[model samples]
Structure formats: structure tokens, C-alpha cells
Target: MKTEIIWMIIGMGAVTYIPRMLPFVLFRGKELPIFLQGVLKNVPFATLGALIFPGILLIQEDIWYGILGAGAAFLTAYLGANVIVVVLSSIAVLTLYSYFV
Candidate 1:
């Protein structure tokens, strides 16, 4: 059992390390193409979309609630509301939805 656990840890570590290390190692001292750079510049937004899109549409089995919550967040963000305000608004919306729905 101990040996199996050790191997599992080692395997997981390797899997995690390779992806984390590859960009630094591979991109180091290299000038990427302009299109590639543009794409890379948008990587953060793309990643955010990937992380937020799926579950952002489904909260408490009501997809519209999630959409409204996201819209509130976006509006707060656009209006320069601080992080606390944005988060509080989202929580307030969801909480009110829970109680009323």
C-alpha cells in the first residue's frame, strides 16, 4: 500500500510538473509569431470563459438566476465597483433568488 501511494504521488507530481514547466522551458528566449502572441494575450480571458461559462448558467437548477448573477457581476465590474461590492451583489442576488424562488 505504501509503495502504491508513493508511485501515485510521483505520477501526479510528474503530470502536474510537465504542464507547468513546459511553457517556461519551451517559450524561453523565443519570439512567438504575432498571431500567436495575440492569442496568448487573450489566453487569460479564454481561460476565464472556460472556467466560468459552464456553471455560470446553472445555479440552484435555475439557469436564468445564474445569468442574472453574472450580468450583475459584469455590470458592477464595468461600473468600477470594488471586488467586495461585486461579490456582495452576486451573493445578494443569489440569496434573494433562493428565498423568493
Candidate 2:
């Protein structure tokens, strides 16, 4: 049982690592097309929105909490902040909301 679990873990790791690493290995020197580059550049923002939108709609206690955080995230992202900064700003807004309300 333990050996099977270990093998499963190894398989999962390889499944994840290969797709990520394969691109770098295969496209080391090539420049992707401009259209593709533009699309790729927006991937993080799109991903963040996809992940957060559902949570915003699903907040049980008060929708205000989700609204505040989402607004902060949107504003920061619009200002071209890093994804980490956008997330942290949203967290800061929510933390403040929790503290006061």
C-alpha cells in the first residue's frame, strides 16, 4: 500500500513538472509570436480573476468582505502591480475589514 502511494506521488510530480519544464526546454531560444506573447502576459490576471470571482459570489457572512477584497485586487491589478502586490493589497483590505467590522 505504501509503495503504491509512493509511486502515485512520483507520478503526480512528473505529470506536473514535465509540462512546466518542457516549454523552457523546447522553446529556449525562440520568441513566441506577438499575439501569443500578449495572451501569455495576461494569463496571471485572468487566472487570478477566475480563482477569485467564485469566492466573491459565495461569501456567506457578508458580501461586503468579498467586495472589498475584489475591489482592492482589481484596482491594484489595473495599476499594473505585481500579482503578489495585488493579492496582498486585497488581504490588507480584508484584514482591516475584519478588524473593524
Candidate 3:
């Protein structure tokens, strides 16, 4: 059993190492194509949209409430509200809306 666990740990380490090493090995001293760079620049937004959009639309309750809360949080953040204020304001708005309407 101890031997098995040791081998398992080594196997997992190799698996993790290969993924981390592959990108560096493949991209070393190489400039990405312009199109690829553009795609990469959009990747973060695409990832965020993919993650948030479905949750915003497909939850058990109405989508508008979640959207409104997100909008409020974003507005507050843009206005340079502190993180606590932004979080609290979002919660307050959502709670009030849920309670009253």
C-alpha cells in the first residue's frame, strides 16, 4: 500500500509537470501570430462571459434580479466604491427586492 501511494504521488506529479512544461517548451522565444494574439486578448472576456452568462440566465429564480444585482455591483465598483460597500450594496438591493417584490 505504501509503495502504491508513492507511485501514485509520482504519477500525479508527472501529470501536473507536463502541462506546466508543455506551454513553455512550445512557445519559447516564439512570437504568437497577430490573429492569435487578438484571440488571446479576448480570451479572458470570453471566459468570463461564458461563465457568467449561463448562471445569470438559467438559475431557479428570475434572471432580471441577478442581472440587476450584477449591474449595481459593477456600477459601484466603477465608481470606486470599496469592496465591502459594493458587496453590501448588492446584497441589500437583492434582499430588498426579494422581500418586497
Compute each candidate's TM-score over C-alphas.
0.74, 0.57, 0.55
Candidate 2 per-residue lDDT, tens place, 45-99, comes to: 9997798778775665787887788789889999999999998998898889899
Give the least accurate 10-residue stretch of model 1, judged by summed lDDT: 54-63
RMSD of each: 2.5, 4.0, 4.5
Off by over 4 Å in 1: 1-3
Q: Which structure is stronger by lDDT: 2 or 3?
A: 2
* Every candidate's lDDT: 0.87, 0.86, 0.84
Task: Candidate 3: list runs displaced more than 4 Å.
Answer: 1-25, 82-85
Residue ranges of candidate 2 with Cα displaced over 4 Å = 31-62, 75-89, 96-101
In angstroms, the error of model 3 at 60 is: 3.5
lDDT of 2 at 17: 97
Worst 10 residues of 2 by lDDT: 52-61
Predicted model with the maximum TM-score = 1
TM-score of 3: 0.55
